[model samples]
Target: MKNDVKEFFDNSEHRPPKFGVLQGVKVVFSAIEVAGPLGPHFMAEWGADVIWLENVNGGDTNRNYRPSEHEHRNDRSMSLDIFSEDGMAVFKKLVKEADVFLVGGKGPSFIRKGITDEFLWAINPKLVITRISGYGQEDADPNYIDRPCYDGIAQAMSGYMSQNGTPESPMPAYPYVGDLFTAMFSLSSTLAALIRARETGKGESVDIAMTEVLMRLSTYNMVDYLNDGRMYPRPGAKDPIQGATGIYKTKNGFLFTNILGRKQMKTLFNMIGCEELYGVGDFKEGFSFINLNWDKADYVESKVEAYFKTKTNEEHIEIFDSMKVAAAPVLSFKDVVEHPQYKARDMWVDWDTMTTEEKYKGVNVVPRFKVNPTKIWRSMPHIGYDNDVILEDLGYSEEQINELYHKGVIFRNDRDK
Candidate 1:
């Protein structure tokens, strides 16, 4: 209560010498896995004062996974038994000063735990309480609202999986798109709510459902069916309606081309020695020749395939560039890391992990800002690493802090094993 936030920044060793655009904002997030924690990680990079609340049991389950290193950075970890009386007291004090609080799990679970919006708004009137879940907080069926779900389940339930991969077998998008997309939605909504809260002096609660986010993303795929009742067959890696937009084998490797515009389509038809196909594109001024020749899809693709087989990757690149065709080589992971464009953009950066002191490389702060630029001032932290400093900031003495730790209200995980 006595600690001035500005004064702490001026004196604390943890403070970065140069902060980001979110320097004055405070965010406290209690998240379990990737879906919950990743949202706040971006805010932390942008200089928000972020505290990650971890359960005393063993901290976030993500800590056991590989991507955990990338998921948690620029955060102070505080392991606490929030279900306990003393722990809730400490949590309430922290929430009293926070601008945003994000939590992950079913809505019913939090309500059962008595951590509802009303309880939090009583502490901080302008707080933006954000909840991340699989199916959101409400539904026509009460049973569905409380159903436990994860990334894959959301993908399957949201129709996202049905539209992906081949018709033979559909596959879920890799690297947890369900979780990451939901996190992105949650971040945007919370920031919007925070802005309104600052202006009108009233808080907002944002409920983000992973399934809903995926369904929204699939709008383009669903619009045709919604209006005309047409369900096109899955085209695998190819565009559903555009025959010329697909991956083709080159002399050396594979290249994907999306020949949509009239000029690009004409260039492809002429180059493939099928100039007669160009006349088929008389539908409109901006119509694509390949699209108009949909009836001759097999013949057109065969010609294009034969033409591509005559050229190497470098030759195809030169031809595409000269013809202004939208095409690129289908790169592998190694090729991506060694790509010249990524290096020129300073995409890769190095940082040392706090606990292991091990060096790691990852992408830098994205969509670089020209002013008050974001930065990675610190790497991932150990569980409850800043317990002393954080408690001290809350006006707790060293003796009281020790007693709290002894009483199991404060906790830390030493992953020495």
Candidate 2:
């Protein structure tokens, strides 16, 4: 088992995979908030030179977030207080040399900061300027455009929250799914534009809206709503599948199951000794029967519940796995992080494994590649830690760097200087 697991990891491991898809590329991150930072985080993993062009006001503010110990690593930080002339000079220098510049904030306010798409384009015609916002790149009325929005706001506006929870009270989905999906879409779209820029010798400003991503993901629900006034809702919805689909409680823990195919339904019925339900097709007959008689739905649910209650979670898992039925335990974080299956699959890594002390936590990169995998090259920068390095790269002398530091145009960790 260990050898097989090792081979599986060796085939897909990120420890020195054939990365460098974005080699020789420079990305300047002029954005600070949550959604803005995410897409670029993945790009940095792809071997690009990502510089965090933070503001001296607070330096990206992500540092102040809870559990932000590892947030300050992996990238170089240079506090570009662009409000000042000297700072704007340094900011322009970075943008002039950058291939992709990520900018975020509200629509009008962010553009008014004097770093427009046109400005960056003229500086570096090949620069792909990417923008992310709650309402997109709007210059509309402040009432709508200037409103503060978060993950829940996107969920509510995009019709996701409406269908997520029970009918008693709709609950917001946790784990920041709304924010994350938006970032993912933005990443892929921006990569496409970056590709186009490389081919066309012209840059593009890609604008992404948070609510729009959620709206696109909620298309199926929109379909039924548009067809009729009724929406395909899941509030208090028991079965997601046609026949048997739900999280069932066993002797030990909860496990989710899906009876999708006719064979699976027949096998489940035989296993439960419910001969009457045998040979019921999942979509064709079982769905019709449940729809026709509410009592039948209740009856089937009760039988499934009873059958699950008779078995331990492990037993249920074993039986289902052996029969090729879909089943999985609803794992918590503690169960997941320590799981042998995930460890064997190389899903995550020990953060401080190579370090002297384990100060940082675990790290799991996103959108794993089969061939050209992404790699983590550096730690998150200390506040303005890359100030000297970036300044020197831009042809600034040590005296010039000291002048900017003394003027408070840049801030850094004391150890940085």
Write one digit per residue (lDDT tens) for candidate 2, span 1-417: 111111112211212222457767788887765677777777776656778878777777767663343443345678768779898888889988988888777665667776777777778899988888777776545676766668899888778888787757776787777778877887888889989999999999888878888888978767767888655446353553244677888898888887566556667766767767543444244432233133355566678778999988889888888778888888999999899988876666434311236445555555565555555544455577678878988999999999998999998764433
Clashes of 1: 0
Q: Per-residue lDDT for 1-417 in model 1, tens only?
A: 211112222212454434677888899999888788888988887778889999887788888775687777678788888889989988998999899999998655776789999999999999999988878876626767877778899999998888887878888888899988988888789889999999999999998888889999988878878998867666677776667678888899999987777787767777888777566543344456455236677687778789989999889888888878778999998999999998777777766775565676777776566666676766677788667778888888999998888898878664232
* RMSD (CA, angstroms), candidate 1: 4.7
- Please give the clash total of every predicted structure, in order: 0, 5
Which residue pairs in candidate 1 collide? none
Cα deviation of 32 in candidate 1 (Å)? 1.9
Overall lDDT per candidate, in order of appearance: 0.79, 0.70
Clashing residue pairs in candidate 2 are 72-380, 73-379, 73-380, 74-379, 74-380
Best by TM-score: 1
Instruction: Name the candidate that leads on lDDT.
Output: 1
Error of 1 at 160 (Å): 0.7
How far is 77's C-alpha from truth in model 2 (Å)? 1.0
